[model samples]
Target: MIFQPTYLDLLLSGDLKKRAADFQRRLKACDLCPRDCGVNRVEGEIGFCGVGNQVWVNSYGLHFGEEDPLRGWQGSGTIFFSGCNLSCLYCQNAEISQKVSGSEISVEVLANVMLELENRGAHNINLVSPTHVIAQIIKAIYIAAQRGLKLPIVYNTGGYDSIHTLKMLDGIIDIYMPDMKYSEPEISGRLSGVPDYPSVNQIAVKEMFRQVGNLVMSTQGIAERGLLVRHLVLPGGLAGSKTVLEFIAKEISRNTYLNIMDQYRPAYLAGRHSEINRRITSDEYQVVVKEALRLGLNRLDKC
Candidate 1:
């Protein structure tokens, strides 16, 4: 066996306090995510993500709705944070995404949540919508390390990320789960209110793949370390699934683990937008899956 857990080993064997302090400094003038709002979140300035310095988690529990590998038997210790960087019109979790529902937590309380999940046999600590609150998450990781949190950390994001921000999570995060929303800029702009999301997401996914390559699963099928790309097939070619598959096969690694999702339905402002007003058709999803397989990406899940 290896000497200590990989991420926890790095933390315990090094001075995490220094890392935490350095990360906290970035919050002063937060360019933490790609949004680069340049607002001082530590000074209580809310930026594009509608969040401040403190991490606002909506829920902390075992989640089985994730991919089979991620969920496994027990479940992933999922901590869903409120306020998203990308305001997708069809955001399923509109309640938590648009409004802060949980109590404001300190690094200590956040650390406890990590341990609580570990005690309950969670495979990993999954941080959902973590782009804006990366600093606090790192600080919490440092604290949790001291208290013996050994499971791998998953950086679950909406794919609008800053490369500089991801650099800080170099040795901390083991799994990078990001959504590749749209392949066309106009579609992204119209749906998520973010222009040039296709190109922006490409850069971000490249950085994630650079950090972690293809998914390396344990004997039990739990992902140990890797980059997992999730793409939700939107209605009326908004997501451009064929192009996305081609990009993964050509630009990103062909062996990259992907989830070809088919669970898209009208939500949030989807009903307001004509292009995204309808649910994804079975044929549309089939075309995307066929393209993925043709591109040699065989690893996929319906959920």
Candidate 2:
């Protein structure tokens, strides 16, 4: 059977638009994320993410660099949102996430970008770094759905999301692909500047799994709806890979689709830190893979 996006139903019932307005209103205080910046984003007040009322998009296109399920035959329609809620010291896309390197666009333009990607044969609309600009994304998705956009919406977040915000996005988002960056609060605070990342990320992931049980796919092997987690293996067990996989197996689901990422090259301010300055060895990646299998996490993503 072919997959139908859930947001289209919300659009038809006009609930999507209402949710958009409700989300936009939160921008007044801007407690959208865990930071609770409290900045008046509706009145163009910039906060920790450095984004204001207008939506800034670094770029949008059909990208094949994502997971195989997301990319499919054509590609994952990726909209790289400019700005981030977390300040990771080793961010790979710091140019887009840290520094404002994209052009600002209105809701109409953002909607058009989604439609254009669908025209290009994209399997899904992947919103990257979406935690900070969720209100804007909801507005654009509503507009896109009204204009014949019918692809699954992927919330590609950094795992530092607020449960309240995720609650607002319950039916709108089809795919929840979040990164479980770290397992220790102190490590997260020192590396990513988020002191409560361990607790916050765990709660956020649990909520995401509750919304979409496990990663589901169509006959064509394209992702339909569900949760696809990413865990980057930090050197010297800094990411606590064993603990994370155990949580997935015990708390979440053994069928949870997980990607134990082996790509942890030191970037941005990583070189400043002695422990994370170097890249992970082949053995390090293999160790995490073994732990995942041992923990009964059989649905590991293919590298």
Candidate 3:
């Protein structure tokens, strides 16, 4: 293997271990995510995320469908954590995110899973929907980094993050893949059921961008560090792609990598709603993509 410093080296620096410990301590009282449920997860209390004391992972494997930079020759070491803080009406991974369909795994086992991914030639460790299991993930990262795990770590989140908790990961996560889900609060609340989501996600995404700027890649084009913003274009512009792009252009850097996705399909509870019970129109997606380009967002993902 190449002589590379473990990803944790950057993250666990400057008393980050103490921050992790303190964050873990708070989870017992459990105000981990933005919800501030305070359910005492250490005692097996399930909060808004439906995750209990232990970490429940749905699957861990090499995923090729991610952005090109993330999926080099070898795929991303994708660990799909079960349960999500927000249950969007049109959620694609409803089975795992909503139902929390996975067996509980110990931190040691989770660390081994990271090792197995590295052994299988994965380019990085990608944590999906990791809000509830941040503590366990951090602990496992500590364990894996000590045992020769040196791959970059990716924090793939839904933009619903706790500022305090994210501060603890300042140097630990190399790649930040956050979704700019909505730009309007009412739309976000109606679809994703998160009140004041625009302000919430904006603050959280700003923090992510502050920690890691634009997407940086290895000489081989694999992601090493930086930020990649994903915005899924929903039907009727309900996902608020236009406003999200504008915010990216105005608030964030214009050079930031923006992924305007067209892969929206009515799933989960979306079918139960009138405006969102169908797939997004091709015109709708084209308009948003065009808007992104007109706004000088060049780093778009076609796949």
Residue 243 in model 1: lDDT: 87
In the predicted model 3, the residue pairs found to clash are 11-171, 11-172
Residue 150, model 3: lDDT of 87
TM-score of 2: 0.99
Candidate 3 lDDT trough over 10 residues, lowest sum: 1-10
Q: What does candidate 1's lDDT look like per residue over 1-303, in tens digits?
A: 322346675676675667688889988888887778888988999898888878888889999999887899999999999988888889988889877778789889999999999999999899999888888988998889988888888999999888787777777788999999888888788788888788878888888888878888888889888899999988877788888889889998888889988889899888887878888898998888888999888877652
lDDT of all predictions: 0.85, 0.92, 0.85
TM-score of each: 0.96, 0.99, 0.95
> How well does candidate 2 score on lDDT at residue 208?
97
Q: lDDT at 169 for candidate 3?
A: 84
lDDT of 2: 0.92
**Alpha-carbon RMSD, each predicted model:** 1.5, 0.8, 1.9
Q: What lDDT, from 0 to 1, does candidate 3 have?
A: 0.85
Which candidate should be chosen as best, given TM-score against the real structure? 2
lDDT of 1 at 250: 91
- Looking at model 1, the pairs that clash are none
Clashes of each: 0, 0, 2
Tell how far residue 170 is off in model 2, in angstroms.
0.7
